[model samples]
Structure formats: structure tokens, C-alpha cells
Target: MGLIDSHAHLTFPELHGQLEAILERSDEAGVNQIITIGVNLSDARTAIDLAERYPQTIRAAVGFHPHEADSVTPADLHAMAELWNDPTIVALGEMGLDYHYDFGDRSKQRSIFARQLAEAAGRPQPLVIHCREALDDVIPLLLEHGFEGRRVVFHCFTGSPQEAAKIAQHGWRISFTGIVTFPKSTELQAIAREYPSDQLMIETDAPYLSPVPVRNRRPNEPAHVHHIARFLADLRGLPYDDLVEETAKNTRDFFGL
Candidate 1:
């Protein structure tokens, strides 16, 4: 079975400029499916366009990232809501709190996050979360908005074991990126080794976090997702093919891919 890069930013300038080569390389690396994420309104449109251009292999997830929360006007939220009408849009968000950088005002971030969560309340689409040093706020906010279980996934997770456990307890999923393969990520690696297989998923988070061997490389692409899958398999002590099939199945099931 082909592998899937559950989360990526194919519309980002670093990867968007070489789309053809990227897809070719991804195919060669057994990464046949990808969900390109949008962190803003403009890229969200581009993401849907890319998905439409490559309907058989790519899909889109749209939202306003925490950093962009500072400038989000009511019109922007309205426009984002309208994007869900597109058949290619599979999920809502890369949205959430980001206390680490504080790129957006904390108050605004929470407000936008809550608003998006409210929008997502009864929608069939799942949510792709972008949380960093703010799980305390993130988890509660998600709950307040009535989201739980398999409907949410913390993408590029780099939280403490306790945080991960909390997410698991809520029945939400967690996705790992190249960061887990780093030599210094002992805690994350340990968590990955024991995380529930059914809820575990892998991604390249392309245009960022290139895994181990290629850790030094810039502009990570979807093709590098295979490295993440292989590393996770080895860390979890499962056969590589088995890991690929399992994660691919989980991604398809979670995103309704």
C-alpha cells in the first residue's frame, strides 16, 4: 500500500515552486497521498486549487493559524467558513493557541480558536490542531466547544508525556513529525514507542522538520515522509510495511480521505 503524508504545507512557497518534482519524488518514495494544510485564507484557496489539480493524490485542510489570529477580520472568518463548501476541503484548522511565540495576542488567539471550534462544533470534518506550549488552554477550549475523541488531531506534537496522555484520555489523536526522530527528543521518542497504535499517525510537515538522515536538509518535502514512517516503525518495533499500512489506514479513517 502507498504511504500518506497526513499533514503538509504544499502551498508554501518553498514547496509550491516545485510541485511537479515534489509529486514525482513523493511517488518514488511511496508517498502517494498528501493533505496540504492552509494556515491562512490565501493559502487555503491555493490548497484547494492544488487538491483540485491533483484530485487523486492530494486533499486540503483550511484554517486560520494562531499567528494570523491578530489580524483576522470578521470578513476573513466568513470567507474561511465559505471554503468548507468545497468538496476537496477535508478538515478545519491548524488553528489553536500558540503561547510559545505569542505571535498573536493571547486573547485574540483564544477568541479565534473558540470561534473556529464553534464553527466546527457539528461539522463532519475533523480538526487539525497547531498547539505549542498551550495544551492547558487548547484542551479545555476544545472541550468547551464540544470537540473531543477522534475528531481532533494535534499535528506536529511536541508536548510533554502528561500532555500527550491527556490528549489520549480525551480520545483525540496525535501526529508526529521529523522532530520525533531527532537524537535529543528522548521523551517524545519514548512516548511514541508506547502511544496507542490505532491513534498514532506520521507526517513530514513538509517545508519543515525534515527527519533524521535528512535533518540537515532544507525545505522538507512529502517524499521525506517515508523516513518518518520507517523511523516510527523501527522505534515502535513493528515491521516497516505494517507501520505504513497502519498509519495510512489511520489517516484515511481520521480525515475521511
Candidate 2:
């Protein structure tokens, strides 16, 4: 069964530095497509390059991470806007709120999010979102912008069923990561089971939130996506192979792959 690692940082130092081996392992595990996220200005270039060099296997998302919220400049957004046309750059995010660590000022984070959204206006691509303790603001922003019909994926979803319902109602997609495989992820499991398969996706979010049975490690790899897929299958009462196929198709459709 083929699967897509919908969100990952294969452009990052650790993984990108050894992409030959990484791609080999990912292929071995049946991970055919991956979305490389651009966390900041420079990251946009690397992700784009990676995608261009591996068009069939890799794609990229252009946005500034909330941690770099305070440093986001107009020039940075402009740079991302320029790369929007590179067929390899498929989405506009991995951007949103992150108040847990407050790596950057909260207000600055909000402004950056809005600015990126405005910059991406009229563009035909899904938004890769990353929200943490900011749904109240995040959800409303999407509504205010009338971000309907545009695919928006809540990457690494940590929200509840109610939140999932709201996002789903808006026609936005939700992508689950390795976190769902954790033992205390009952809430996530429940939501995954309830959400329609079309609105669902799978990602590794590698070098960050590695899935269970392997959470202790850092710099997670795309191959771990299989574990997340298995968990989702159990959650939805579907066979593992069937779930993989559906998620793969969903990922391609969500990102217009």
C-alpha cells in the first residue's frame, strides 16, 4: 500500500543532508510522496530546491514558523510569494500559533499569520496549519478570511472532536501525525475515527513529533508514517491496506498532487 508523508522537514539539516538514504528508506516503506515544510525564509529555498530536485517524491510548503514570528519581515513573505509558482511548492504553511513555548511574541505571531494568508490570497494551494493553544484565534481567522473551498490542513492536529467538527464543517482537512500513536492519545484516536476519510491525511512531521513505539527519538523519518497509518486504521475500523490507500488518495487530492 502506498502512503504520503503529507508533512515533514526532509529539507532540514539532519535529514536533507542524507537524502539519498532517506529516500531509499522511505521508498522501502512505501512512502511515495512527502511535503517538505519551509519553517522560515531560508528554509523556503531549501524546501523548494528539494522539491524541484525530486518532483515525483517531494513537495514543499512556504511559510514562517511561529517561533520565528517576531523576525518575519515583509521581504521574507515576498520571497515566499515568489517561490509560490515553483510547481514543487504545493502549500502555504506549517504556519500558525504556538503559545506553549511562546518562542515568539503572541501578537507578532498573529500578525505574521494574517500577513502570510493575505500574501497567499488568490493562490490555488492548501494551507498547512500548525496550531497549539490558539484555536480561538486560529479558527476565527480562517472564518474571517472566508478561507472556504481552499484546502486547509490542520497539520499534527491536537484539537478535540468539537474542534475537528468545526474545521471539517469549514471543508478544511485534518492531518494526524505520530502523536496519535501515543498511549494517552485517546482524544485524537476518537476524532480520527469520527472524521470522514476524505478529510483525513497522514504526516510524519519528522525530526519533531515522532510517532509512538518510537517517540523517544528525535529527527523522526518518513518511514514511521506506517505506524501512524496503522493507528488510524484501528481507529476507523478499516483494514490497514485499505486505510493506506484512502489516506494516500486523500493526501493527493487535498494538496492537488
Candidate 3:
């Protein structure tokens, strides 16, 4: 079975126009499906359009990232609701807190996040969250706003094992990226090994975080996911194909692909 790049930015400018070639390379590298993420209204629409264009190979996750919290207008949320109803829109995020940069006001970010969580209250669609240096705030907010029974995956996970255990304990999933292959990311790799295999998944988070052996590479792409799969396979002591198949099944089941 081919692997899935569960979180990527194929709609981003750096990789957008070269999709055909990039997709070809991805296929050559054994990538089966990709989920492109959107962080704003324009991005969300563009992601939907891309999914429509490449329906067989791509899916969309639309939401306002915390970085853009202050700029989000009521009209934007209304537009997001329209897109969220589309059959092609698979998830509601790339949304959460980002205290690292704190690009937007923290209070606004929390409010916007809670509003979206309300919108997602009983929906079947999962959430693709981007949490950076704010798990303490992020975790509580997720509980306070009613995220108990929903599907949530923390994309591009760089958290410690304790944090991962808590997330897994809360019945949420965690997705790893190229970062796990880094020589210095021993803690993350440990989490990958210890986390429940059924609850674990992998991604490229394209246009970013290219793995080792190509750690210095620029504008990372979905084609590099195999490196990550292989890394995890070695770390977790499973065959490469087994790791791929397990993670692929996890992604498809999680997103209902």
C-alpha cells in the first residue's frame, strides 16, 4: 500500500503551480493520497478548489489558524461554514494556539478557537490542529470547549513524550513529520516508538520540515514521507511496508477517506 501525506501545503505558492510534477514525484515515491491544509478564508477556498481539481489524489482541511485569529471577521467564519459543508472538505483545521510567535493576540486566538470548536460540536469531520509551545493552554481549551468525542490529530508533532502520553490518554491521535528523523529529536523519536501504533500516523507537512538524509533540503514535499516511514519502521522495529500500511489505514479511517 502507498503512504499518505496526511498534512501538507500543496496549495501554498512555493508548491502550488508545480503540482503535476510534484504529484508525479510523489507517485514515484509511493505516496497514495495527500491532505492539503488551509489557514485562512482564501486558503480554505483554494484548498477546496485544489481538491476538486485533483480529487483522486488530494483532500482539504479548512480553518483559521491561530496566527490569523485577529484578522478573522464574522464574514470569514460564515464563508468557512459554507466550505465546511462541501463534500470535499475533509476536516476543520490547521487550527489551534501558536504561542511561539504569538502573531495574533492570545485572547483573540482563544476566542476564535472556541468559536470554531462550537461550530464543530457534533460534526463528524476531524480537526487538524497546529499546536506550538502552547499545549498547556491548548489542551485545557480543547476540554473546556467540548472536544471530548471528536477526532483530533496534532499535525507536525514536536512535543515531549509526557505531552504525547497526555494527548493519547485524552483519546486524540498524533501525527509525526520529518522531524522525528532528526538526530537531535531523540525525545520525539521516543514518543513515536512508545505511542500506540494504532493511534499513531505520519506526514510530510510539505513546503516545510524535510527529514534527515535530506534534512537540509528546501521546500519539503510529500514525496519525502517515505523517509519518515522508513525511519519509524526502523525505530519501532516493523517492516517498512507494514509501517506504511498501518499508518495509511489510520489516516484513512481517521479522515473517513
Please give the CA lDDT of all the candidate structures: 0.92, 0.85, 0.89
For candidate 1, the 10 contiguous residues with the lowest summed lDDT are 142-151
> Candidates' TM-scores?
0.98, 0.95, 0.97
Ranking by lDDT: 1, 3, 2
Candidate 3, residues 227-250, lDDT tens digits: the string is 999999999999999999999999
Where in model 3 is the C-alpha error above 4 Å?
none
**Between candidates 1 and 2, which one is better according to TM-score?**
1
Q: Write down the RMSD of candidate 1 (Cα, Å).
A: 0.8
Point to the candidate with the largest lDDT.
1
The C-alpha stretches of model 2 lying farther than 4 A from their native spots are none
| Predicted candidate 1 versus true structure: per-residue lDDT over 103-144, tens digit per residue | 999999999999888888878999999999999899999988
On lDDT, who's better, 1 or 2? 1
The 10 consecutive residues of candidate 3 with the worst lDDT sum are 141-150
Q: How accurate is candidate 1 locally (lDDT)?
A: 0.92
Name the best candidate (by TM-score): 1
User: Model 2, range 91-157, lDDT digits (tens) per residue?
Assistant: 9887889988899999999999988888776788889888988888888787767687578988999
The true-versus-predicted C-alpha distance at residue 102 of model 1, in Å, is 1.1
